[model samples]
Target: MSTLQDSGEKPSIYLHRLQVALSVTIKRGGISPEKADQHLLKQFCRGCWDNSLIADLQLEQKKMNPPSFAELLLLLRTEEDKCTAKATRMKQHLGASKQRVLSHSQRAWMSSESEPDVETTETTPSQEQRKSSSAISQPRTTTSKTQRGKPKPWYCFTCGEDGHIASACDNEPNSVLVTTKRKQLKEKQRLWESQNPSADQSPHMAFIQTNGL
Candidate 1:
């Protein structure tokens, strides 16, 4: 049927229908074989069908004989199969490329999830508390040593006087002279304490020593 030219049939099916149309036209007989070829070529698009096969058909007709329609149909089928195979290969390549891209994306997502966060790697509260306690405990021993080893003031220890010893209390010396007189006063106080173990031992002696005098 002429309508079969536009149908979504395979190229081989359309070629078979075209051969039937040619046979029916030839049996009706007013037009010659050459005229039938020209009529069919006009009814169908030369470029949409195979231009090379149409040229071969015309060449065969000029030799005073033509191939059978079945032979022509076979050539059309061969070209169609080659085109179909090429299209199938192109589709396969496209599908493989999409799979590779999906694999890469999945790998990146897995690596991101596997890594540890910065906040999670940091020190815990218990570790921080231990460090603070050690720091607080360290200062106590150092503070006690500083308190016990501190230097005494420039004053007499026995009588609690500013400038002179208990034996020189009658002289009443100026306080400014104490800096040069401190060593000699310390010697005399040492000798007095050594000789009089049960002497005055006044509360002022304890006060002077405790106050770092």
Candidate 2:
């Protein structure tokens, strides 16, 4: 609702959009026709930038209620038309008044300035005619002091070596030295499985059960 606004939209345009939104909500079975009408009217009023028009409609609504939503829209539309017409008339009048004053002032100024320079005189527009023609127009290039560092060297984590990556390293992982117990566990499991020919347990399950896993 905070985002809902008429902007320059006519009441009918705004109402059309509002009806589209309300139709979906109304079909979901909570809001009735009368409640929806109230919401539409309230939100339309809230969305309108013309406070005077909304106030007038609200006043007339209190004095004599509209028979339907269409009737209410008719009332609002009538008020909007009247306000628009009045504003147009006021703007025209103001513009005409300003025009009259401007013309009178212009006449006085022109009469005073007419003695100084004649229109028949020709003056060279040296400054306006002077334009620059570039031999080579290129995009600007800038070098910053912050870009002074040399690129760091590449190193392999596999064998603690430089100049090559880990993926290309030929040596086996040095981590195998730390996991010697894992190798022992695998060897013992293989031996036990060979000894017990009728084992039906899951992989490593027999090893874990027989040992202190």
Best by TM-score: 2
Pairs that collide, model 2? none
lDDT of 2 by residue, 1-213 (tens): 332643344554455455445555566775775576666666666665555556655633643333344565557567656655654554366543343343332222122211111111134435433221111111111112111112121233455343332333576656543245445546655665565556554623532332222
- Name the weakest run of 10 consecutive residues (lDDT summed) in model 1: 112-121
lDDT of 1 by residue, 51-163 (tens): 45445446335333434343544565666565556444543664433433433332221222222111122344487765775676566645433322112233443444543
Local distance difference test scores for all models: 0.44, 0.44
Please give the TM-score that candidate 1 achieves against the real structure. 0.32
lDDT of 1 at 53: 42
